[model samples]
Target: MNVLVIGKGGREHALVQKLSESPMVDELYAAPGNAGITEATCVDIVETDIDGLIALVHSKDIGMTIVGPEAPLELGIADRFHEAGLKVFAPTQKAALLEGSKSYAKAFMQRHEIPSAAYATFSDPEAAKDYIQAQGVPIVVKADGLAAGKGVVVAETTEEAIEAVDDMLVNKRFADAGATVVIEEFMEGKEFSLMAFVNGKDVYPMITARDHKRAYNQDKGPNTGGMGGYAPVPDVSAEDLTFSYEHILQKTADGLIAEGRSFTGVLYAGLMMTQEGPKVIEFNTRFGDPETQIILPLMKNDLLQVFEDVLAGKDPELEWEDQASVGVVLAANGYPEAYKKGMPIPQINGNVYTAYAGVAGTDEQLVANGGRVLLVGAKNDTAPEAAKTVYQALKQIDNNTDYFYRTDIGL
Candidate 1:
């Protein structure tokens, strides 16, 4: 069957690459794909262009469509496809509120009794500011709507928290997305990502992955989608994984079903291993970006089959390689802020796999086009070994000073 993968980032590139390896997929196509996705035919339709995408799917006879990002899902692309009798691997718009609206997710968690930090939603700037002042220092202020993973501010002081509230609710930093905000007490712990393929209440968890959200090393700097990630995190014990599945993932799935929104597709739990156990920091309705880059390489099962089985509501037998994989994102200079683009990227020669997040021009002459340029992934017997191999491959790229990547990945 021919498969079409949506989105135009590193996660989409990784999905395209993985799906290309499936024997069930005779042909693969990507919408607005980047330069690193050489394994499939790239289409010109933007991910959010539902009508354009539907036309492309019919024109190409795409048997199944898989969405890679949250934006298209929030735009109800899956609903549109279903309305046309097309098969798509994504949750519906009503279900996508798990990621689209912070306040909604917080309330959902509360209703389900899911373990998460206590938070309060506010629309008035003064009310939010007052809540912040009462909550004291070291709080988390989040825009109620999507902000490309940068709408959250982890403030360390009352002044910082108030400033963040004003920026979101008063100053309109994120516009309507920030008109309402969710402020919660900051939880201190190590965070990890747990993604699962879901078909209603049947959830199949993938290998654990820990992503470096901060831009610079040692977990310092502003978050920029993700800087790097590694799969099968060694520190996350098997017992903890089981607990997360029973208390968090399963409950979340059941809660969504009870709420009359049966979620199908990826359910990503951004969990923090606090003193109270694994508590959710946030939830994403689709695959995590750099985390997908690392996790897909370790998946031994056919991804196409997995998607088909989930859509059919059948239990899919998933398998993963024991090997560890690490991915490091190479971003443009001054990333998470203003940065230059179109810088020529010299060819990299190594065994590493490259997934393009942002680039322009043809494959033969690629140039940086976004904040995160590309991700290089490597697999080995251990996480550290994989990180070493990935970093070694990164050194082969020219103009190393022009791009920045976290050096402490998998350490």
Candidate 2:
């Protein structure tokens, strides 16, 4: 069957590559896909144009539409596809509120007794500032709406907290996304990514991954989409994984179902392994970027079949290789900020798998087209070995100074 994968990033590239390997798939297509995904036919439809996407689905006879990014999912693309009698692998708009609106997610977590940091929502800048002053320093201020994963600010001082509040509410840093803010106490711990396939209350957890969100090394600098990641994080024990599935993942799916919005797509939980236990920092309704780049390589199951089974409300059998995978994102210089693009790229070689996030040029040559250019992933028996393989291949790309990647990934 023909499969349509949405979005134009490393995540979609990974999905396309995996789906292309499926014997059940006759053809694969990607909407606005990147340059490295040569395995699939790239389409011209933008992700947010739901009508255009629906029309394309019908025109291409796409048997299943697998969404990659959160924006399109939050825009109700799946709902529209369902209305048109098309099978789509994504959550409905109502269910996407788990990621679209921070306040709503926090409220839902609280209502369902899901373990998460205590937070309060505020719209007024003055009111928010007053609350921050009372709450003390070292807090997390988040834009209630999406801001391309940069809407959150972790303040270490009361002054910084107030300033962030003003930046969001008064200066409109994130624009409409910052109109309302959710401030929560900062929890200290190692962070891990747990993604699961969900259909109503059936939640199947995948291998755990930990992504570096900070731009520079040593967790310094501002946050970017993601710098690097590795799967089956060593610190996250099997017990922790079981706790996440039973207490967080399952409860979340049940809560959504009870609210009359049964989710039917990837449910990603950004968790912090605190001293007390694992607590959710945030929830994403779709697959994560760099994490997907690493995890997909270790998946031993056919991705297309998994999507079909999940959509049919049948528990999909997922298998993963007993190997660790690491992915390092090579971003354009000055990434997560103003950066140059259109720089020529050399050939990538070795055992590394390159998932392009941004690039534009003819087949003969490729150039950086966005902040994050591509992700180079490698698989091995251990995380350190995988990281070594990835970095060794990354070193082969000539003129390394043009792009920046976190060196501490998987260390």
Instruction: Count clashes in each candidate, considering only residues at least 3 apart in sequence or on different chains.
Output: 0, 0
Q: Which 10-residue span in candidate 2 carries the lowest summed lDDT?
A: 393-402
| Residue lDDT tens for model 1, 42-145 | 98899889999999999999999999888898899889999999999999999999999999999999999999999999999898888888878899999999
lDDT of 2 by residue, 1-411 (tens): 999999999899999989989999998999988776799999888999998888888888999989999889778988898899999989999999999999999999999999999999999999999999898989999999999988988999898888889889999989898999999999999999999999888898999999999999999998889998999898888888899999999999999999998998999999999998999999999998789989988999999889988878787889999999989888999999899998986577888888988888878899999999898888999989988988888777646678888887876
* lDDT of model number 1: 0.90
Which residue pairs collide, candidate 2?
A: none
For candidate 2, the per-residue lDDT at 147 reads 92
Candidate 1's clash total is 0
Worst 10 residues of 1 by lDDT: 393-402
Error of 1 at 389 (Å): 1.0
Off by over 4 Å in 1: 397-399
